[model samples]
Target: MGDPTPTNPQDETSTQPGASPAGWWGKLRDRANQLRSARRLSRWFNVDDDKVAEILAEVRQQLPTTEALLVGKPQAGKSSIVRGLTGVSADIVGQGFRPHTQHTQRYAYPSEDLPLLIFTDTVGLGDLAQATDAIITELVDDLSSSSSKGRILILTVKINDFATDSLRQIAVRLRQQFPTVPCLLAVTCSHEVYPPSQAN
Candidate 1:
């Protein structure tokens, strides 16, 4: 070998006289430094308090101050519907619901500063001997207290169990209680029920 091929200085394995070669520990240290630098840069870019506040204020102003009461039986997909509408995770939904009464709970989206939509979830009716009466009473009282004109009632009914007497009675009672409030019937678990054509 004419001149012992010259080693590239930029090579990580290159070692000078009396200097140790950069091993796995050196590579790990370099990656750690890169991560630290990246974190610092991220923090620098993400720390605009005034801008964040302005954006939040604008969003709050644009959001509609509407409330929707979700009434359904147990496991009627009330929380699932709320999560779908609000794009919040199941964990957040579970944590956000504030118990209003023994049979009712309320969840406000963006549970922090300003909430856009307020959802009131009622406990399952017709489960116990007096559950139906208790739920209706609680709901009626809550609705009577709310002066917000934008309030609406959402009824979640399982598609397969739509013809149940209990569900029909609950619907009739709620309609009577809040005649003016628009009632939206959300049929849940449609996949389990066959199509009309399939019914003999």
Candidate 2:
């Protein structure tokens, strides 16, 4: 006891405690597991397998129906969404205002047995005088004559500076024209401007 031995018990790594060590097979198994994880991560560069699986699930759940109209202003992306939903690339619709829809464009969903949904693109409200009147007239005539069930009208508009008289006036007229029918108003270009619900 010439010099007191300083025993630092806190230094656990410095002391060789009697513990069982992992064998060679255990180390090799851990390395293989790490390599497998790295390979799985690397495979995601070309395509996302998770997203593909999700889309396929969505396609399976989607039910096809044939009673609706896509009504919106010009260049409001109605055509784009219609094409996407229907899974068709061809010209399902023509651009300009046609006097009469002799052949109302029908966009078909997958599954041959499913009924094809017809999308009638009406002219922009601003493009014609009393557009609400024209639209209601067409819708009434079509529904009355067709063998199909009642249709749903989906109205799309760009959300921005809606204080103008055009939208307010149109809304009033539409309410008057089809008081009993159901209407769905969809606001597009929402990324570019605030939605009406958030507006002050």
User: Could you give candidate 1's per-residue lDDT for residues 1-200 as a string of tens digits?
Assistant: 58898767766445543245556567778889999999999988785889989998887777677888988887888988999999999999999999878988889887747887899888657576556777778878877884543788888888877545666676798788779889998988876677677853
Q: What RMSD does each model have against the real structure?
A: 10.0, 14.8
lDDT of 1: 0.79
lDDT of each: 0.79, 0.58
- In model 2, what is the error at residue 102, expressed in angstroms? 8.8
Alpha-carbon TM-score of each model against the true structure: 0.61, 0.45
What TM-score does candidate 1 get on C-alpha atoms? 0.61
Error of 1 at 82 (Å): 0.7
- Model 1 Cα displacement at 122 (Å)? 1.0
Over 4 Å off, model 2: 1-65, 90-115, 128-131, 161-181, 194-200
